[model samples]
Target: MSTDPTRLSRLPIVQAPMAGAGGPALAAAVTGAGGLGFLAAGYRSADALAADIAELRALIGAAPFGVNVFMPHHTATPAEQERLRRYARSLARAATRYGGTVGTPAPGAERDDWDAKLALLLAHPVPVVGFTFGLPDAAAIAALKAAGTLTVATVTSPAEARLAADLGVDALCVQGAEAGGHQGTFDNPDDPAPYGLLTLLALIAPETDLPLIAAGGIMTGRQIEAVRIAGASAAQLGTAFLRCPESVASAAHKAALADPAFEHSVLTRAFSGRWARGLRNGFVARHEAEVPGVYPYVHHLVSPIRKAAAERGEPDGLALWAGQGWRLARAEPAADVITRLVDEMAAARKAHA
Candidate 1:
C-alpha cells in the first residue's frame, strides 16, 4: 500500500470515472470520504468538461481527484462505413418501435473534440488524468507531466500495458472483461477475448513497474483486499457505486441494478459499436447480432432512442451498464459506501492475515 498515489488522501479505493453515471456530486462525495474520486469526460464537450472541472475544484478545493477521457478513435474503412449506414437504417426501425427517431450519422461526427479537451486539460491541470480507447501521443503525455499531472491509462491487455508504459503513463487501470461499460481495448476486434480481472492483473503486474489499478466485477471489500494482494496499488470500481444516492445514474438504471428480472449481465455492442457489459434487455437481445463495431457513430445513432427510453422510464431501451457483481450494489450515501468498504476491507485483511 506504500505505492498508493501520493495524491490519494487515505484509502486505496478509486471511484471509476463512469460517463452518464458519475459526476461532480458523486466524485466530491467519494473524495470527501477519504478515497480518490474521478469525473468522466467521455461524453462532454471541452467547455462542459471544463465547467465540471471548475465545479469539482470549488467543491473539494485542492483535493486530489481524476478526470477520464475517451481517446480519439480510429477512422473507419469503406466497408465498415457502409455497415454503419446499414446499421443506422435498422436502428431507425428500432427507434420507431420506441416512439422515437434516431440521430443522423454524419461522416465525422464520432469525434469527441479530443484536441480541445486536451488543450483545456493542459491549461488547467488536474491532479490526475486517465485515458481509455487509445493512447495519447507522447508529446501530449509529456506536456501533462510537465504540468504536474499524473497520467493513467486503461488497458485490457499486457501489450496495451507495455505500450502505455512506453508512453510514460504513471499508472495502468487494468480492466477485466467483466468491467461495465466499454472494454478499453485500443482496437475493436471482430471478436474479443478479454482476461478476467485477477488474470489480467497477474499478467500485467510483472510486465511493468508502473502501478496497477484493478477494475471489473469488484463489488466487495474482500475483492478489494484480494486485488491488493495480487499486487495492485488500488482498486477502481464503477458498478459498485452506481446505486449511490449521489450517483447520476438514471432511476431506471438504479432500479435495474437491484431488479430480480435482470438476471445477469452480458457483453453487447447493440447500445454502441464498442463491446460493453450491461444487463441483457429486449434491445440488446434483439440487436446484439446486428450491431457493427463502428464506435461513436453507432453510439450517436442510438442517442435519440436512448433518450426517449429514459424519458419514458423504460429500462429495455437504455444501456444498463453493470458489472457481474451488480447484485451486491447498495443504494446509500456515497460516504457510507466508502466507510463500509473501508471497514469491510479492514476486516478482510485481518481475517486473511
Candidate 2:
C-alpha cells in the first residue's frame, strides 16, 4: 500500500466501486491481481460496510484496497418533493410486476448515514477510501489521513478536481460523463454537460499535480495506456468488471451488457433520481420524463421495484449500469481480466514508444 503516485502508475489498474455489483469477492480478486480493488459503500448500512471491510481485509491479508462512500447533499425542494410524490404514484404499475408496492419517499429522512460510516471508518481504518457525489468536510479528510488512509475523490470536471485537490485529497478519480452509475458531480445538476475522460484529464492535469485516476468508458488495455499518456496515473473501470465471474452484478445485468436487444447505454435518473448511465430499457422509457432531480428519495422509491425485478431475473426494471463501452465487456474471471489488461497496456505502451 504505497502512497506514491508512481506506484499507481506502475500498476495502472483500478476497479470502480459498483454498488450492488461489487462485493468483497470481486474486490479481493481484483486486489489479488496487481491492481487495486474498491468496495462500494454507497447503499449499504454502516454495519454492512464494516462487515465488507473486515471480509476484504481477511481475504487480502493487509493488501491495500479501497472503499467508496457517497457524500451527503442538500435535500430536495418543495417542487421537487411534489414531483417525487407524482413519480412514486406513477411507479405503482411497475411495482405490481414485482408483487410489491412502490416505496414511500421519506425525503425528510433520506440519507446514506454519513456520520455513522465516518465513525466506522475512523475507528477501523482501511488502506484506501474514496468519495463520490461530494467532497467530505476538511476535518473528515484530515481524520482519515491521520488514520493512514489514502483518500481519493471522484470528480467529473476540472472545477471539481480543483475543489477536491484543495480539500487535500491524495488523488482524483476523474469520472467522465461516459461513466456508468452516478455522475459524482457535487451539485447533481438537472442536465449535466458531458465531459469526456481524456478532455477532463488534460484540463485538470495542468491545474494540479494530484494523481488522476481516469474512469468512464474504459474497457481495454489500449484505453488504459491512452489515459496514462493523457496524464492519469491509473484507470478505474466498473462496467468492464461487471461481467467478471467474481462480480456480484445481477445475471440480468451481465447478460444485458452483451444483449443485442439492449442496444446502448443512456444517462437516466429514472431509477435513482441522480443521473446515472445504464442500458436503455422499458423502465427508463416510461419513467425518465417523470423523475425529479432528488437523490436517495427517488432511489428509495424505486428500490422495491428493482429488487423485485432482480428476483424475477428481469433486466428491464433493474439498473443495468454500464458505460459507453459496454459492448467491449467480457465474461471471465477477475484475475484474467487484469492480466489481459496489463498485457494489453504493455503492448500499447511499447507500440506508442
Candidate 3:
C-alpha cells in the first residue's frame, strides 16, 4: 500500500459513512485497523459535528479518516406536502399508541447547519469530506477543496456519476440500489434508477477516470473482490459492519437483523421519503406504495413516532435498514471484522492462484 489516492488495494477496505448508524468509535476502529474510516455529519448540529471531529481526533490520534456531509435539500411543493400527508395517515395506528399522529408535522428550515459546518471545516479541516443525497454544486466543492479537504460524492447511475465527476470532486462513492439507508437520489426520490453494483461500476468506468468506491450488498471477501474486478477502485461496506461492536446500531435493529423472518430486504420509502433497501417488515409492507413525495419532510414527521416506538420497545414500528446480505453479517469486534475480511480476501486470492 502506498500514499496513492487513485488506488484501491492500497488499503484493502474502507468503511462506509452510514448516517445515523455511524459514529466516531466505529470510524476510529476502522482507521486503527489500517482501513479508512468516515464520520457521518448528515443529521447533526454544527457544534455536535465539531465535537465529534474533536473526539475522533483524540480517539484515532494519527490514523487517516474522513467525514460525510448531507447535501442541502429544500422543501417539497404544497401539493407534494399534502400528498405525503395523505400517505402518512396510513401509519396512524402506530402513532396513536405513542400519543402522536403521523403526517401532521411540517418541515421548517431543517438545514443540517451547512454554513456553520463549512466554517468549522475551514477552521479545522480533515483529510476528507464526502457529499451524499445530491451534489454540492461547484462553489461548495471549491470551498471544501480550499480548506484542504478531499471531496467525495455518492452516485447511483453512471449519469449521476458523470455529473459528479464533472463537478470536480476528488472521488465518487458509487452506491448500488441494494445499499442500505437513504437512496441518495440527486433528483426526485420517486424516480428510482436501480442499478446493481457491478453494472454501476462498469457503467461509470467508461465515462470518467475518477476513483470509484463501490457500495451496496457487499457481504464477503469474494463480493469485495468481485467489485474490484468489475472496475471499482475500492469497496465500501456498511451492512457487513452493522453488527460490529463499534457500530451504534440499537437493540431492535440488531435483533431484527438476526431474525430469519426479516431476512428478506426491499426498497421502501416508508422510513424516509427517499428509497432505501432494508429488512422487509410490517411497516414497509403496509406503506411502500402509499409513501409521499417529500424527502426528509415525511421522515421528520415520523421520526418522533419512530423514536417513541424505540423507547416503547416496539420493533414493528421502527425503521430497520439492512442490505440483501444481512444473513452473512456477524456480531464481532470491528477489529476482528476488518481483520477477518482482509484475511478472507487473501485466502480467496491464493485459492484462485
Query: TM-scores across all candidates?
Result: 0.97, 0.96, 0.93
Candidate 1, superposed: residue stretches over 4 Å from native = 1-7
Question: In lDDT terms, which candidate is top?
Answer: 1
lDDT tens digits, residue span 1-353, model 1: 22235346688889999999999999999999998999999978899999999999999998899999998876778998899888888888778878789887565556688899999999999889999998989999999988888889999999999899898888999999988999999988888899999999999998888888999999888999999899898999889899998999889889999899999799988988998999999999888998898898888889889888877889999999999999989999989988889889999988977
lDDT of 2 by residue, 1-353 (tens): 56743264237788899999999999999889878889999988899999999898899896778889998867778888898889988999999976767887553445588889999999998778899988988999999999988899999888888899999999989999889888888887876796998898889999988888999999999998888889998899999999999999888889989889998789999999889999999999999998888888999889889988988889989998999999999999999999999889889988978
Stronger candidate by lDDT (1 vs 3): 1
lDDT of 3 by residue, 150-252 (tens): 8888998878888898889988888888787777778655667688878888788878777778889888888877888887888888988888878887777
lDDT of 1 at 149: 83
RMSD of each: 1.7, 1.5, 2.3
lDDT of 2 at 62: 69
Displacement of the residue 276 alpha carbon in candidate 2, Å: 0.4
Higher-ranked by lDDT: 2 or 3: 2
